[model samples]
Target: MRALTGTGVLTRLALRRDRLRLPLWVVGLAALFASIGNSISGLYETDAARLENAQVRADNVVTRAFTGPAPGSSTGALTVSEGLVFTCVLVALMNILLVVRHTRQNEELGRTELVGSAAVGRHAQLTAALLVAGLANVLLIVLSTLALIGMGLPAGGSALAGLALGTVGLAFAGLTAVAAQLTESARAATGLGGLVLATTFLLRAAGDAFGNTASDDITVNPAWPSWISPLGWGQQLRPYGESRVWPLALLLLCSALSVLLAVRLSVHRDVGTGMLPARRGAVRASSAMLKPIGLVWRLQRGLVLGWMVGIAVFGAVFGGIGDQVDDLFSSEKSAQFVRDLGGEGDLVNAYFAGMMGLLAVVVSGFTVQALIRLRSDEENGPTEAVLATSVSRAHWLLAHTLIALLGTALVLAVLGLSTGLAYGAVSNDLTAALGDLLETTLAQLAPTAVLAGFALAAFGLLPRLAATVTWAAFAVCLVIGQFGTLLNLPDGLLDISPYSHLPNMPAESLTVMPIVVMVVLAGALTAVGVAGFRRRSLALGG
Candidate 1:
């Protein structure tokens, strides 16, 4: 009983800590979903048009792979098909980061030890973390439901859809709790949880993509693989089609069981340790640690390699889809939707341009994460030690920043090259496909640079607020660039994001002037950040 005695107190404390962070995530997700729903509603205004869209989706393997089957014949069903999986993914990520931040991350940072010195029980922290995650998911469900209902969707289906998203998040929250027990470091715990998420997501995608058609222009009956994953269970709910509620039971069961396992595992390990033994490192430091950039790379290479592989894989899959979707734009309404999301000119070209633009935003997430390493190193007490050597403050800061910049190019290049290869092979014209995609992806560099520079500015001028600023700025850019037009968000608010100036390539002709201006702005921001960081002490903010 004493083990959870402080859970109430800790829960409040956790809420206080995450007030800003969690609200931002919840609002952004719900608004983005609603914006997308509004766009889908506009795109398929007529019953005939909706029917045509459904038929196109049913025939499109790529759409099925990404979104699964439409749950029903209505616009709401179409919205669910388009947004539910993406919503699930974002919610799961939210829970994973939430739980891990309160549990393993706090432990690694020694906050747990300070708490344990008081009257808190062994299980109190984990319990509080899970409670906070549940509350966040609940908020998401309610806001999302209201958002759907506001768009004139049926209340019952809208609530069910929200429930599906929330339950998936809860299941992953519980899973991540177990992962926190299994790993010694926050990064390790997060990586373990991410592996599980990635595996299950792929299974769900494969199952849906390869499933049997339940009826023409309607649901796809997923295979057995879908039944094994929490995300898959969410998809099986058929909220707008069958309106089934039993699938939620599976997700709830998974969450309950995983939580029990985590609580049991808590008794077996000491605070700051893990159920899995930590691997011992070598006695001597590597020569790579001698230089700032090399040390930065050593810390960042795994993250870089992971993004590169993921972007490359997705690029190839979508490139193949791009080739197949050329005929899918015959309908004027479909062309209009594509233009709204993608760009103008040829529909297929617009699709490619849209994909590249989104990928660039995705890569900027990597950029923000990479830039925030400055805060992590400083917090973990390594920056002082490294800078104690000959490494100047600017040298240390720029080393990490340069890797983030260069790493962007490497990832973009991999995405371009892989997509080009796939598209060319499918289209039987390697030369032109390779050239166009390579150039299109390269054009994204200016936007990516602008984002990186912004994040770097956060690191420089606001040492204590780097991660928060970086992530917030990037999130704003992503939501605006991806969904602002669809939602009809004001041009002023939309233009505040760097990606607004990003040229949607191939669909719109290239302009050197905008590219050059973006480059100049990025350089100016980067210089400001480096100069500010140089002026401050290692212990400046705190």
Candidate 2:
């Protein structure tokens, strides 16, 4: 308690700094859950539709691996079964960033050192960050619960779902607190946390996939692997089934232990350092170091590689799940399920088209991150140093922008190839799958470029607001473009997303005009951003 002085003040500070960003994340996630609930409810309106759809998915190993068990046969249960893993992943991400931002980033920028001049305890900042993250999760739980209840889901189940999701967030926040103690660099800290998250996800996936199902076929009791993962504990709660409280104890207990470990470790390091020493750069520069693009790549290459690997895995999973429609159309009732998803007569084409849209949206996150790196560099000490020399702001911005655009296209290519390979293996048409998905993914480059341009424009014109604005835009676009139709949103609203302009490939004839227009639009927006950035003075530390 004596070592926790100024924790309350730091908590308020963290909250104030993140006021806008935190609410956006919470509300956006709640809305996303509501949309998913509404869409699943609408799609499986009847008992027969729900039951048959469940049966179709029950035996599919791919579906089981991805979605885990259906806790019950109801719409809300189906939503949890399909949505729990994905939603928890997002929640975990939100918390990891929160912890890393408040702890490691502050230290990296020397803010912690500045704060330490006061009577603040060594553990105060980490503790305050965790508290703020806990509060955010509380808001998420409340908002999401209300959203579900508003959608006419059961109050108990809704609360249970929200609680389970919140617990996973807290657990990850605790884990990230520990990661922040291990690494000197914020990026490396994030990567360490992500590696743990991925490991837990794989454990949960394996447990659920190999779980023992009841005679009902829909109900599953996951294997021993799930018991250790916080993610798996969320599912084990069975919000739609038993609504167990025991798993909450597991989550809380693990999180408490992790937090204690982090607190003890905090005493072992100085304010500006970590348990692990920071990496020292090489003494000599290479030829590639002279080029701006190469330098940008060197900084962002880890991010690019991570996205590529993630996209590849997801692409394979999504693509391999493609031809499994044979099992899905078990009866007349289940076939109507396909029609409800707005599929044409050819289910495969519709599935692939939908997945392409999702892939584009996912890959675009990396694009925004790459572009925002320029602003971050500016906010830190590097931009001024580089600009003091002969390097123009235009050249600096161009290198970042080009990498964002090109890296996005490259990742999209990996997505397409991986999907094509897995889908081709399953469908027995390797040439056709490769050719079609490659074209479909490439067609998305124009739309992704449009998003990159917007992010760059925001960075140039609104340096302080660049990160907030682009992430907000990304969230809005995701909700609107991804689930706008399911939510019965207007076409006018949906069309605001750049992804809306993507061609309906494989599902319909190629609409090259939209792609061409988007490309032109992206170029114009890129010019505006570059021009604005050139005229503006550096607003460092704003």
Candidate 3:
């Protein structure tokens, strides 16, 4: 009871604080579902054509791996399944981020301390954060239901899909709450939650892929695996099939149990302490940690290594799928589409080029995150403390910035090398594929540099809103780079993404002009950021 007092008022405050952000999340999710529905309906308007396409797609291992089981016969069912699986995962991600942000992150920043001193109880804060996340899930359900129904899906099936998606979110919200209790730092909590989400997604992918195989006539019931993963349970609901709704009840039960566990953990631990004890570091600094640059490397090394490994894995998987793409495009219709999207050339090279572009986007995200870390450290007052020593502001900023740039490039190269190695193994053309991959990786440098420069400039000029501005820029770039073609956006609008200027590699000749221009822009932005940072007063902790 002491833990649950003043929950109502705190819940209201949380709601008010998240007014804009919550709505954006809900609307974005709704739009994603709606867009998917609309796209599917438009693509497969005829039942006969839809059935044929579904069968063909179901047999395609790559398609199956990406999008779970194809709907058996009905066009509507197929559309629903495709949208439900992807949207449910997206919703789960949203819930985890929201819950962790409001709970663990708030505590880490000392915001909870201010409220704790008031009439608010310990459990009240946790309860309020969970309530906020739960309410957002409810909104997600309602909006998704409306969007699906508006798409002309069966009312019951649509509602089931919405419930399933929301349930996945609720389940993860609980998981994040527990993680928040276990970890001392918000970063650790968020990272652990992300890892769980990734694991769930992989489990679901593997289950779905295994179940759909031809030799598996015994029907490897995906329901069992789906039960193993909260994400899997969402997919197992099979919205358009039987519309089983009890799985959602299971999710709710799991969520409640998780919340109870978190509460218990909270009660046991001291304020700002974690369930897992922190290990002490060595008393003396290592030789590698002596210099400022080395210190930066020490701080960022884990993240950099993680990103490299992840990108490399992605590259390998994508490369493995390349051969399958060639087989799929053997059909004239698919081949024509591929050619139109990625000029007439060796299909493998064209596909690889497009994949490399996506890799560049991911690498850009790394660059942005790395650059923004500097601003975060500065605003947190660590930068000021560091600068009070013998280090100059220019040296500190440049050291971090150079690391970001070089780190991103290294990640890109790793991706290229891993992908090339996999593709070469399949094609038995090691030299050519490796060369092509290296060239494509190099081509991405222009855009990566531009994004890094922009992030640094924002951090330097608008120290207060640097992180927000940088992320917003990255989001815009992501949209332009990914959805521009699908949305039929004009070239002028697409050109806003720096990557738009870099010619598609492996399929197109290398163009030095755009590369040179990007380099100049990067230099200019870096100079501006450095100048602004030099002039501005050093920021202190909030």
Estimate every model's Cα lDDT from 0 to 1. 0.85, 0.84, 0.78
- In the range 1-542, model 2's lDDT, one tens digit per residue, is 76789999999999999998899788878877777788678667788777766765666667877777778788888888778888898899999999999999999989999999999987889989999999999999999999999999999999999998899999999999999999988999999999999889888988887888789977877889888889999888888777888899999988999999998889898876789887888899778978778888888889999999889988988888888865555455445544433345677776687777777887889998988888878877478888888888889888888888889989999999999999999889999999999888888888888888898888778888888899888877776876676567888998999887665566766787888899899899899888888888886522
Could you give me the TM-score of model 2 versus the true structure?
0.94
- Looking at model 2, residue 243 earns an lDDT score of 83
Question: Per-residue lDDT for 1-542 in model 1, tens only?
Answer: 99998999999999999989899899888887887788788767787777666677767776777777787768888888888888898899999999999999999999999999999999999999999999999999999999999999889988999999899999999999999999999999988888898888888988887888765756688888888989899988777677889999999999999999999999998889999998898899899888999989988998999899889878987787776664645567767767887787788788888888888888888888888888778868579899888888888878988898889889999989998898888889889888888888888888888988887787788988888778878878887887788668999988887777766777877888878988998999999888888877665652
| Top candidate by TM-score | 1
Which of the two, 2 or 3, has more TM-score? 2
Better-scoring candidate (lDDT), 1 or 2:
1
Runs off by more than 4 Å, candidate 2: 280-283, 326-345, 540-542
Q: Give the TM-score of candidate 3.
A: 0.91
| Candidate 2 all-Cα RMSD | 2.3
Model 3, range 418-508, lDDT digits (tens) per residue?
8888788877888888888888987898888888888878878888888778888888887787668767899999999998887778889
